[model samples]
Target: MPITYDSQKRIFKLDTKTSTYALLVYRENYLVHLYYGAKLPDDNLASLMYRGRFDSLSPYNPKVEDELFSPDINPLEYSTNGAGDFRISACSVRGENGDTVTDLRYVSHRILPGKPKLPGLPATFAGEDEAQTLELETVDSVTGVRAFLLYTVFEEYGVITRSVRFENRGSAPVVLERAYSACVDFPGMDFDMVHLYGRWAKENSTARHPLQHGIQSIQSKRGMAGPNHNPFVALARNGCTEETGEAYGFNLIYSGNFAIDIETDTRGCSRLLMGINPTDFRWKLSPEESFTTPEAVLVYSDAGMGGMSRTFHKFYLNHLMRSEWAKKKRPLLINSWEAAYFDFDDDKLAAFAGEAQKLGIEMLVMDDGWFGNRCDDHRALGDWAVNEQKLKGGLQSLIQRVNALGVKFGIWYEPEMINPDSDLYRAHPDWAVCARGRDKSISRYQCVLDMTREDVRDNIFRQMYDVISKNNIEYIKWDCNRHISEAASLQLPPDRQGEFFHRYVLGVYDLMDRITTAFPHILLENCSSGGGRFDAGMLYYSPQIWASDNTDAIERLTIQFGASLCYPIASLGAHVSANPRTSLKTRGNVAMCGTFGYELDPVKLTEEERALVRRQVADYHKYYDLIRYGDFYRLTSPTDNPFFCEWEFVSEDKTEALTTLVVMRQPEHVFHIQYLRGLDPDRLYREEETGEVYSGALLMHAGLNLSCVSWESPDGDSLVRHFTAV
Candidate 1:
């Protein structure tokens, strides 16, 4: 069993394959954190706690004078606000007395065979034999507020997930000021804070800095998990690298506003708190009401950054993603977003599909402007009815024509947005999210639909289902072009206004669930102005997400690399766009590292470019399984080496590997070596292109020389090689 309780010592230990997390019930009530690191034997860990006589400045518990017990110095399992200990609180609740003083004492706990599903939330699921869960119940006596702290350990993956559920057991209401999902206290502050930070087109850029004395954090206040800050943070011990040292990763399985707080106290002790951002968040729990938080994942890797990333990738693929398409081979799609972008009509689309089919593209996705008065981004967003004027016939006709060309058909929809000029908006203006008696703030000339309202979701779903059910569409590119501005919902009362953000997210999940349940065969791909909402929550419904709108090959090298730290490459929607900054081959090479596809007009490509597209498509099909299911390794990062980048994917059985190297434009020099990973050392491998055979020990240790990949190459600065074990 991964979870065990030492009854006599009053200790609970949660163990994974590689790490052990232990906590103690101090004095039979207060829960205290003991240790969380490399695996440890089953024993009483209460000795790890410190207790010493302090000066008058320190407040010790009067009931335990001999022990000199002070809450400020001890590592609390769940810190509370207005308590004697005050660094950063994991939770805060205000009762009828209007006081935020909350001290929860441990009540009881339960050990379960498997992880429990979080209601109306996306969480990792596992079988009884794969994982175990621990539910530690605590409560505040004054307010009658009870909290259930949840911890699930994946025995095989070596991953741990945490969450919290708060119940109002008293007669009156209690307003939850702040509620964090998980908190961990580390004794030393010798670590580096690493997180992903970017904006708009440059999403998920790696940013690392040493932990400061005071609080250091990253958060998202925008409605969605905006591109400015990702809902993830990592602590790496000093001198940690991709291949060495200890590292800890924390990520929330949510797509809304979130915050990850890291605080280092005066004694050099560090604490991390992660959950939904409390900026504009509050939940009033009436008697008998309960609120469950989103799940948070913790990954510990003593083998370094690479080890941490690989574990995250494996865990999410097996547990987090619920779609049947999660492990399946994705079609090589050609999206019309950049090709025609609401300009081309039926004939133009048919011609484009013909060219795509000729080059072996599997799918042709018709993007915006195929609906009511939707020629551009300014109008017809909420209208899902097909525009017969653009198709000459209808969406079904276009699908028939595309399918006749031996290619699958896909369509795009933005159902959660409304334009002022649309018929739906004019009929139900109150469905838009806005404050009462105030003009609505708009982005991209669109207002967000009040998803918290069931009527609004039903209306949009009816329209979308009508079109999808009638057509032979195999895929749907769901998109949200803007974040919420005037977040107040018309259906919600003022006292319950703070519930809009969370309820809105729940509404999204509801709609997605309905669609997937109705049409299980449809391949759904989510997009929020490109990568703004790329989090674990979105992955539950959609197997892939549009990584970013910036498809520039050189920029994608960095963007994809940074995202690869926590997300699997199979989930990244990368396309070969008409980004003139790099060669066509380089663009294809970079895009192939993700869910490979094209966004440029096939008809516009020259004969030579068309031939190259054919080969890229062939490679995409040939390496489909290896790229999607293989272990990924980052040999050289574009962020570290500005002039070059290299990454690889090795099969699970260590039989085959594919590696790509890109030398940046106007390179200073081509002196570089790429060290590969995840291969059998004694096995001999043969490179496909050169037919050169070498032992894995020599290839991985000595690495491949890249002086030949100069700027003068006929295909530009890119090289992709495949190796098969012999």
Candidate 2:
């Protein structure tokens, strides 16, 4: 059992494989955090709590004998507003009496065998025997507000997911100003904050900084989990490395506006809070109404960043993703967006599919421009009808032709967008999202649809269902090319206008639920002008996402490296493209690290290039299983190393390994030695190319020597090494 209770000490100890989290019922009612770190055998962890006397300037002044203790100086399990805790709070409400304080005390707790489902939200779920959940209920005596803090412990992965549900029991309605998912307080400020930050076409670049005295935070208010910042943060010890020391990771499973804040107080205590961003966010809770926040996954890794990443990878792969294709090897696909943009016709598409089939590609995805007047980026976004002018025959005919050529067919749709010139928008202009008296801003030459409206969502859902159900489509590249601009909706009341942003996200989730449930067999890949919407929320609907628009191999090294911090490699959609700036071998090697595919036109390839494509496809199939379900190790970081980048995938049994080494900028020395990891030290492994056997211990400890000169190209050099246990 992962959860155990100590009635004598009134403490709850939750244990995972490598860590233990302890909570105590302080003052017999107030729940407070005790400890969370490396696993301990004993349950007497209450001694870890602060025991010193109150300071002279304390908020709990004069030591009142009968009053509740001041929470400003105490470590609270779930801090709430009106409790005098001035830092980041988990919940804040404005009651009808005009008071904003909520002091909740422990009521009761229940332990269950498996994780409980979070209503209307995406969460990590597991088998009954694989995990356990603890639901702790607390109530505020003044306002009759009840909060249920739910925690699920994955014993094997050392991960605990936290979420909160607040119910209003008072007669009058209360407005919730802020509601966060999880909060963790550390005793000292001796750690560094690490987050993923970047912009469009260069998503998920790593950034690390020492925690300061004040608040250090990362957030996204661009509606979606914007490419500017991802919803992941890690606290690492000062001396932590990739393979050693302690690291704690907090990842939110949401796609809307989010905030992760870490505040170091004057007392040196650090509090980390994560959830939906309070900026431009508010929820109205009437009598008997309840609100549920999204889940935040917490991981404690004593083996450092690599271990932290592997833990997240395993958790997401085994528990978070519910799609049938989660564990299946993804098909090798070729997309037509970059190949022909919006200019290709049915014959051109068929020709591309024929060439792709010849190269062992399993699927051909026609991206954009297949629907109503979508000849360019400016028009016909909401119009989902087939463009007979471009296809000559309807979409079904083209799909059938592609399917007959030994290739599966997929189509793309930007269902959340509307072009002003589109027929759908011209007919129902009110369906577009806009403030009542304001001119709507445009992005990518399109306006966002008012998904907050059920009618609009239903109409779009019907259009998507009609296209997907009528055609023999094997895949769907569901895309959202723009962000919310004038967020207000005409249908919403004045007091409810602040709900538009979060409501839009809920609308997206609802639509996705309908499509995914109705068409369970189709492989779905989510994209937002590339990786803008890439997060755990989207991963529940689409197993994979287009990592970014920039397919340049050199640029991808940093992008993929940062993304691996929280997301698994299988979730990144990487493609080989014929960028004049990069070599084909380099491109293929980089793309191989992700869900491998092609983004360039194969028909334009020369004989030699076509042969290379065949080899790439063969290589993809050869090591498909290992790459899809392996323990990833980051050997070299592109952001840290200026000359080269290296990484590897080692199978669970340590029997097979595949490594890619890329030379970013050639150094003076032409020879380099690469150290391998996650191998059985005592076993002997043979390199596939050279037929030379070496001890795994020696390979991991000593390393492999490669002649960079042989792999050098005009742009850069990329070499992939495969090894098998012998």
Candidate 3:
């Protein structure tokens, strides 16, 4: 068993393959965090939580009257507001008298064989033999509010998931001001924090800083998980690197307003909290009604940042993704966005399909202009009907024509947005989110639909189902082009306005469930103005996301590299775009690092360039398995070495590996040696291109120097190599 209780020490210990987490119950009430890190042989960890008397600080309980037992200094497992501890709390609640204060004490607990499902949310799932769950119940004696703390330990992955469910057992209703999912306390503050932050065209850029005295956090209040900040954070030791020191990672399984906070106290102790943001969030819990927070995943690695990353990758691939197409080989595709945008007609699309078939591209995705009057971005949103003026013979006819050319067909949609110029918006202006007596704000000439209303979802679903059911569409590119503004829902009362954001996210999950259930074969790829809503929550419905709108090969080196730190390679939708600055070969090398595709017009390319496309398609098919399902390793970081970028993917059985290196323009002649990772030390391997054989130990330790760039073009170059164990 992965979970066990020590009756003598009053401790609950959870263990995985390489890590252990333990908590202590003091005086049969307070829950204290003891330790979490490398595995321990026994559960004798009560000595880790030392108690000391603080002058002028009140004791935890009057009956005990022990000055050394103050709650202010203890490492509370689930800290609450106004409970003698001044640090940031995990939860806060207001009673019927409008006073906000809570003190929840340990009550009882149970251990289950497997993980339980969270209603109306996307969470990791596992079989009975793969996982074990622990449910600990705590209650506020003053208000009869019970909070169920849930933890599930995956024995093989060295991962733990945490969540909370708040139940109002009192007669009067209680308003929950804050309900963060999980909290952890570390002894010292000598650590560096890492997070991803960027704007629209530059998503998932890595940023790291040392822990400060006050709070350091990353959050998103833009309705969706905006491109400005991702819903993830990591803490590493002072001198941590890609393959050294200790690191811990935290991620949330949600796509709404969220916050990841790390606070260093005056005593130099650190605490980390993660869940829905408390700002503009309040949930009213009626008697006997419970509200559950989204699940958060925690990973600990003693082998440093890369170790933490690989653990997350394996966990998400095995547990988070629910679609059948998750592990399957994705088809090579050509999208119409960069080629023609909204000006493409059915005849023009058929030309794209025809060219795609010549190069062996498997799918042709017609983007943005087939429905309503959507020739441009200014109008026709929320109108799902096809416009014959653009397609000439309707969507089905265009799809049939493309399919006849031996290519699959795909279409784009923005179902959660409305344009005032469309019929759907004009019929019911209130369907869009707007504050009372305030001017409505619009972005990209669009208004967000109030997903909190069931009628609104029903209307959008009918229109979508009509087209999807009639056409033989194999893919759907769902997009949201703007952030939400003036987020007031007319369907909710004034006191419940705080509940709008959460309810809106739930509504989206509901609609996704309906669509995916009805059409199980369609390949859905989500894009929020390109990578804005790219997170674990969206991955539940879609296998891949458009990483960014900037498809330049050089720029994507950082974008795709940073994203691979936490996301798997198969989840990034990379494309060879029409960037005239870079060479065709270089573009293909970078795009092949992810879900390989093309975003340019094949007919416009020169004859020589088209020949390169055929070779690239062949390479994609040859190396698909090694790239998609292999263990990733960061060899040389683009941030550390601005002159180049290098990474690798190794097979799980240590028999094969693929490595990619992109060299940028340098100031002078420079020679760099790239070391390979994740191979058997004694095994001999042969490089496919050079036919040179070397032991894995020599390759990883001695490495090979790359200094042949002076003969190449000034525009830079890229190289990819394959190795097989001999």
Candidate 4:
């Protein structure tokens, strides 16, 4: 069993394959954390709890009788405001009588065979045989507010998912000022904080800093989980490396305004908190109403960041993503957005598809101008009708033409946006999210649709469902181009106005659920102006996401590297684009790390380029499984070395490996040695092209000597090496 309870000690221990988390009920009531690290034997681990005598000098509840009962300094399982803990709280509520203090004592707990679903939220789920859940119920004595701390342990994956549910059991209405999903209290502060941070075109850039006094956090307040900051934080030991030492990760399974906060108090203790951002967020819970926070995935890796990443990848692939195509090989697609943006007709699209078919591309996605007066980015966003003038025979004809050429067809839709000139907006102007008397702010020449309104969401979903059902389209690139501005919904009452952001996210999930359920075969890819909405919540519906708009091969090295810290490479939508004018081979090699595709006019390529495209498509098929399901290792980072970047994917069984080395600038030397990982030291591996055999230990320790002849010559600045065990 993953979870075990010691009733005599009043202790709960959650164990995974590589880690153990133990907590105990101290003083017969208060829940306190004991240990979280490498796996420990299920014996008397209660001594791991730090019981300092000086902790009594910190803040305490005067009403409590115990002398060493300071909630401020103790390692609390779940800390609440007004109970004496002042650093950062998990839940805060104002009672009907204006009382803010909450003293929650453990009431009961139940150990279940499987994980329970989080209501209206995306969470990791598992079969009864694969996981176990522990639910601990605690109630505030004064207000009768009940809190349930739920923990689901995926023993094999070394992951524990946590969530909190609050129910008002008292007579009066309670306003929830702040509610976080999970909180962890550490006994020491000898760690480094690592997070992903970036802007629109450059999403998920890695940043790390040392732990310091006071609070430091990464947050998003732009309504959706904006591209600026991702909702993931990791604490690594001082000397932790990619392949060694301890690392703890927390990722939220939500795509709204989120915050991940870490604080080091005066006593050198650290606290980590993650959940919905309290800024511009509030929920009113009536006596019988309950609110469930999103799930926060926690991973402990004594084997370092690589192990942590592999754990997350495996867990998300098997549990979080629920599409038939989750484990299937993705198609090598050609998108028309960058090639002929708003200027292609039916014949042009058919010609593009014809070229793609000849080069072995499996799909041709018609992006942005196939529907309604959408010649440019300025108009016709909410309108979902086919433009007969451009298509000449409608969407069905285009799909048929593309399909006849041995390529599937995909179409793009911005269902959450509304252009002022669009018919849908002109008819129901109030459907656009805007303050009652304020001028609607425009982003990308469009306003966001008020998805918080059920009618608005239903209308949009119906339009999309009708189009997808009537046509033979196999894929949909759902895009949300802008963030919410003037977040006002006419349908919501004044007191509930603060609920608009979260409710809007729920509406998005609802629409996504409906469409995905109705058309389960479509390959849905989510995009938010190129990686804006690239979050785990969106991954629950879409198997892949358009990684970014910046297709520059050199820039993408960093972008993709940073994103891989939490997200699996298979979920990133990357394409060989004709921007930055890099070598075609380099472009193809850079994109091979993700869901490989193209965003260029295939017909415009020379015969040599066409041959390279054929080889790239063939390579995609050859290594699709390995790249999709392999253990990824970051050998070198572009942020650390401006001249080059290197990474590799090794199969789980250590039989095969594929490594890519990209040179952004000419190196001063003629050759460089690249060390590899995740290989069997006793085996001899033969290089695919050179046929040269070397021991795995030699390649991993002494490194492979890679000549820069091809990189320096006109061939390309990128090299991909494949090795197989002999």
Model 2 agreement with the true structure over 43-160: per-residue lDDT tens digits: 8787676734545455652333524355777778988886767777878888888888887889999999998888888889987899999999999888788899999999999999
Cα displacement (angstroms), candidate 2, residue 257, comes to 0.5
Once superposed on the true structure, which residue ranges of model 4 sit more than 4 Å away at CA? 54-57, 61-65, 707-716
Which of 1 and 4 is ahead in lDDT? 1
lDDT per residue (tens digit) for residues 608-708 in model 1: 99899989989998999898889999988888976778899999999999999887754666466778888899999999999999889988999887666
Q: Which window of 10 residues has the lowest lDDT sum in candidate 4?
A: 707-716
Clashes of each: 0, 1, 0, 0
- Report every candidate's CA lDDT: 0.89, 0.89, 0.89, 0.88
Of 3 and 4, the candidate ranking higher by TM-score: 3
lDDT of 2: 0.89
**RMSD after CA superposition, every candidate:** 1.5, 1.7, 1.3, 1.6
User: What is candidate 2's CA lDDT for residue 82?
Assistant: 67
* Model 2: colliding residue pairs: 82-101
What TM-score would you give candidate 3 relative to the actual structure?
Answer: 0.98
| Candidate 4 lDDT tens digits, 234-320 | 999989888899999899999999999898998898999999999988888889999999999999998888778878888898999
